[model samples]
Target: MHQALLVPEVLLEIFAYLSIISYTQTTSTQKLLAALARTCKIFHEPAMYLLWTEIHGLEPLLGCVTRLHPLIYHSGTWWDDSDEPWTKGVEPLSAHEAHQFLRHSSRIRTLNIKSEHPHLLSVIPAEACVFPRLKSLSLSTTYLNLFLPHMLHRCHLLSVDEGLQSFVTRCIALEHLCIYTPHDVHGTANELISDRIHWCTRVVTLSCPILD
Candidate 1:
């Protein structure tokens, strides 16, 4: 049974199936994959590959670097009005930590950042934050302008705030774009969208509200 599982073709098929499940699941199961990696020498590389392939949030990815752990913190109020501390705010990773973070960033192909206050990203220097294998990015933050340029060269799918007028032009490789604009700020959002639509020649799928 061990020999059969060790066959090259069989191992590839097993890894592929695990990768699919990891990608489709809502909650990230990288920890489970990490555990599987320790079970045997042959499963190490493939298990680690699946664990790093698609990152749902920045915290787990940043957690890979031991030194950066102390810099991470939480800074938000509790929803239930309880005195419990919030563990969501993250301090900026230092230049050294940023470099360490970049080492793992290369393996990340998809990144989804949905937090209201994604302070963790601000710490990493824009130059060092480039993701070589990154193809998809979802950012819902007011600081879209800060990080958009660093990711533009490699990202093919993007979901960002509608107010980033100039940043939209640099998405030449984009095949899908999703813009989220608040109803109260529709005027500014519409103006920016209208001015920028001409620059998005590669966008095959565009999702945004009708601009008045």
Candidate 2:
């Protein structure tokens, strides 16, 4: 009798379970599994459901991942400041790559990157709207702009300088928009965002930004 051969698929499942334990929150581990699943199809269902169903990050409130699933997402602001010694020449995850990760998420209907790091932000390809289910967007610090023309149910304006003004001027069907900016900037751009709020209508709620 021949010995049974262990399938690579089974091994991948084992690896995924092991990798997930190291994650404290649900997001990173799920993301890792999603990445693994991309290597093959057998892992798709398990990986997508396990990881894509929900995502949590260090923030104050729920974010983009919430749009995909209505699960309780803890928002605690956490950052790793330790500088790992240079190994070979590996680079940090790129903005493009981060956005691509969402494409594979298969369940990310919302995206929240509203951290203080502006460089962590990047544009999502118009064609790469993997989350056709996407209905909401939240920025890390409102330092970015939205060029994608798709209609959103709710759009949270990141606390930015001039990006919000630039954004308000574009959204035509935007029903809900929250902006976090300086009082002066808001006062100045309020006219602009309000001007375009509707061809002839104004927004429902406007949160006044305080000067720091």
Candidate 3:
């Protein structure tokens, strides 16, 4: 009985210190935490904050919503093509969920919206967004050309589409922009990433396709 009471407390402290990414590496851990969280309100707070803050998995996220109430954290969820458990059924980015996320925009200081999901553009609002602490905005989307001119300053890793030599018009407070292009899709000009952009002449790294 003594160990049982102490176990959850121990887990809570340990979980609070661990990085958000580690929580999703093992599906079993996620399920375990979810189970513990459901046991009482105490477990729920950490489970939701620690887990939802850094979301990298879908199944666990889906499970989270089912167990917990609607979340308001702007978890830096980076769902690129490299991610796994790619169940087509999830469609990870949905309009319904987007609203849930946006509603809590204040809670989300840093958001990572990858370019892998072309449809995600529709789910997110363009201008007039208010994220007080939002210092980093990472966008890896198919609609880079459309949103870049507007939201680049909101993020550090500004992922773009195509390696086009466009003039760095306005990317104040920008840092670490990544342009992604797959091997098979060479010359296809998918995404371009320009980094280290801030109000001043911050170091910027621009990635584009080399025309050989």
Error of 3 at 124 (Å): 3.6
Q: After superposition, how far is residue 5 of candidate 3 from its true place, in Å?
A: 11
Q: Rank the candidates by TM-score, best first.
A: 1, 2, 3
Tens-place lDDT digits, model 1, residues 89-109: 445566676667666666677
Whose TM-score is higher: candidate 1's or candidate 3's? 1
Separately for all candidates shown, the number of backbone clashes (residues 3 or more apart, or on different chains) is: 1, 12, 17
Work out the TM-score per prediction. 0.67, 0.44, 0.43
lDDT of 3 by residue, 4-74 (tens): 54565666676665446456576555555566578776566666544445333223233334222222122
Using lDDT, give the best candidate's number. 1
Scored by TM-score, the top model is 1
TM-score of 3: 0.43
RMSD values, in order shown: 5.7, 11.2, 8.9
